[model samples]
Target: MSKPAKRKVILGMMAASLALTIGLNPQQADAAVDINASASILVDADSGKILFADNIDDQLPIASMTKMMSEYLILEAIDQGKISWDDEVSISDPVRTLSLQTELSNVPLRQDYSYTVKNLYQSMAIYSANASTIALAEHVAGSEADFVQMMNDKAGELGLESYNFVNSSGLNNSDLAGSHPEGTDANAENELSAKSVAQLAFHLINDYPEVLDTASIPELEFQAGEDETIQMQNWNWMIPGVNAGHEYEGADGLKTGFTSAAGNSFTGTALRDDMRLITVVMGAETRDDRFDETEKLLDYGFDNFHEAELLPEGYKPDGEDVIPVTGGKEKEVSISTSSALRSVIKNDEEELYVPEVSLASELLNEDGEFVAPLEEGQEVGQVQLTYEGEEDVEYLYDNQSSSTPLVADQAVEKASWFTMSMRGIGSFFSGIWTSVSDTVTGWF
Candidate 1:
């Protein structure tokens, strides 16, 4: 693009501060929820802002959903050069044995043989294969115990509110053939809050979107041409025509879990009409109930919420639109939001949001004056929306922050030496005249 065109595009962004107008037009605190799970939540995938929540903080068993964390660490290992998708991984006896289990296993394993990390990861994500999950975890961290430690540490790092990782596979230790992670009890299983699981799913897709490529696959063969190959089906039926002929529109990925104690759970995400939503269902009574509840959340979100550009480009806060410019040719520089502020909000809640601005302290002095030589679009600080009404608001990621850079709308060049000298002289005389007038007033 040409320079002018680029500038025009850049200038089209507006940093807006959200100031919730309370009582005047209160938003429905619980408009989009009518779920029957022990814990459930719906969030805007991009903003991490909750649209509906119920018992979201209740910690519950996650079952194979526990693989979500292992998925994250495995993906991280690949990203950090610690491992590669094609690297061969060792298969322990316990993994091989568990893969042979009658009820909870998929994609049979042969410990004497070898499998690539990609092969195991695909099986883990698409099939929620217990043995494949353990294999990837072991490959990434050398042991399921150590991998469990990594899972808990990463949960803490991700600001998960309620989480406990006993193993990488999210299976009960009793199912591990007495070979569960070192420190966990024989009956222990992975657990997380609905919010926490949503948080994990949030980072999983945001950090390694490629996981969806496999997670979305309806079915695949673990060993395409090998005799020991097993056909795997993704438990996440939300994927289009993935299972039971049930599908949700825009459904692409996420994770699913089931265990007697954990019941049924799903971390499902979908995208449609430029608005993506993530839903979590925990402790559901039936496998199909989880998907039904997820569909309920997705339907409400898509039907009620929209991506609203609340602040238009060139929008400036009511009283915080200009920055004092010291040493610049102009006394003050006009500023605007660096980008248009958009949020997934319910249709009736737009009037409740207002824009506010804040500046970087280092860039400005106590009197709110910035030094000269600022380029157009030079970022200064940020604008954030604050809600004071009854509804609770939170971002899924712990470190998720308000965006839209507060910037200088126009360039400001330093004043010439001649201009500086003249201004200094004028100030000197003006100060003397003020002092003389004060003295005369006191005498009178």
Candidate 2:
């Protein structure tokens, strides 16, 4: 058979296996087109599952969207109690120097000017103020160089495998801008993929939900203590949908960026009841195109897909049993899969099948007891789930199949046998020895 024919045959066999395992009614699966800028992605924020992706892994300059990491680390500092929103940050000479450069955005900050940390965050998130970013970085890390290090460190912690940062402000090249004449060294560009940006956006909203309040404000004017008030407008056009004269309900706050090299880029988020989705569009031809593409992607995600709760609450897998442990306080301990177990269901005519659960092997024990010092939520054994279509055959002679393993949630604990046996043996040996010695020496 030809390659296409062979693929179809294999798919059929795999579908059959899936149907038997998950008890799913056989249904057809359809593919969807990914629409966006050069590289785009839409994903379920809570699950980190990719709903749609176009050139997701390709790394590119993210432009002002790089501020997201800056904002994240700053907020994280606040959350850790290291910095407070009300804390006053003095504008240092370095910050003053950067603000003086006209090529970059600034709030006309002066040396010795003091602004609340909260206001700086507002400036960064609301207006994408480059000066505010530098001030906050300097305040937080003592220098922009140290703050960029923190940004890279946070990216690593987030598992952003294809991301890097060289500056808190997403300056393309300092040499080209000639912003810092004395410090005219060309700064390396910050990089991130569309998928990773989506993930980072999700982390911001999901983990530190309070940031949304600042980012979502439609407009705010910044006053620097008797200095001229600067009118700040939100960069995220989706908020209230005023950019294109179209209203998008449930549109929340996010960031947008543009640079000669990075092109027009955006990371937008929307919510429809319980289902929250994030969309990232990078490297668009024009500013308007980026907004239009992002709006379209958001619409597609909201209209075509929905959150399907696959496993009901408190639903445990079948055939789940107690796993034995050695050298612990208990002989065997029980574990159950705790995942909510859900998937994104497409709004198509074909019936969607359920995923089947499987186990890798039974639990094992060394000698009479299990391994010691088992912590809660530890995986003692493996379980897998296979997703497939339902088979048509009704009788036993029909073809059946298996699928790739989905890991089972396993919990481990101390085994009681080891604990009890050791205690008993120690007591018995001590008692006998003590009695014999006492009898021989008559020193009870």
Candidate with top lDDT is: 1
Task: List, residue by residue over 143-193, the lDDT tens digit for candidate 2.
Answer: 777888888788878777588777887877552244331232476677898
Q: Write the per-residue lDDT of candidate 1 for residues 1-444, one digit (tens) a residue.
A: 999998876665422112333332233334445687899989898989888777888889999889889989988999999999899988888888788874885678886677999988988898888888888888888888899999999999888889999998878889887899999999998888999999898888888988889889998877823566677888899898676555988999899898888998899999999888999999899989999989889988898889988787677877778778999899898888867888887677777776667788887877779988888998887887665445656677655644577789999999999999999999999999999999999999
In order, the Cα lDDT scores of the candidates are: 0.84, 0.70
Backbone collisions counted per model: 9, 16
Candidate 2 similarity to native, TM-score: 0.71
Candidate with top TM-score is 1
Query: Which residue pairs show collisions in model 1?
Result: 13-339, 14-337, 14-339, 14-340, 15-337, 17-355, 17-356, 18-385, 19-354
Each model's Cα RMSD: 11.9, 11.7
Give the Å shift of residue 75 in candidate 2. 0.6
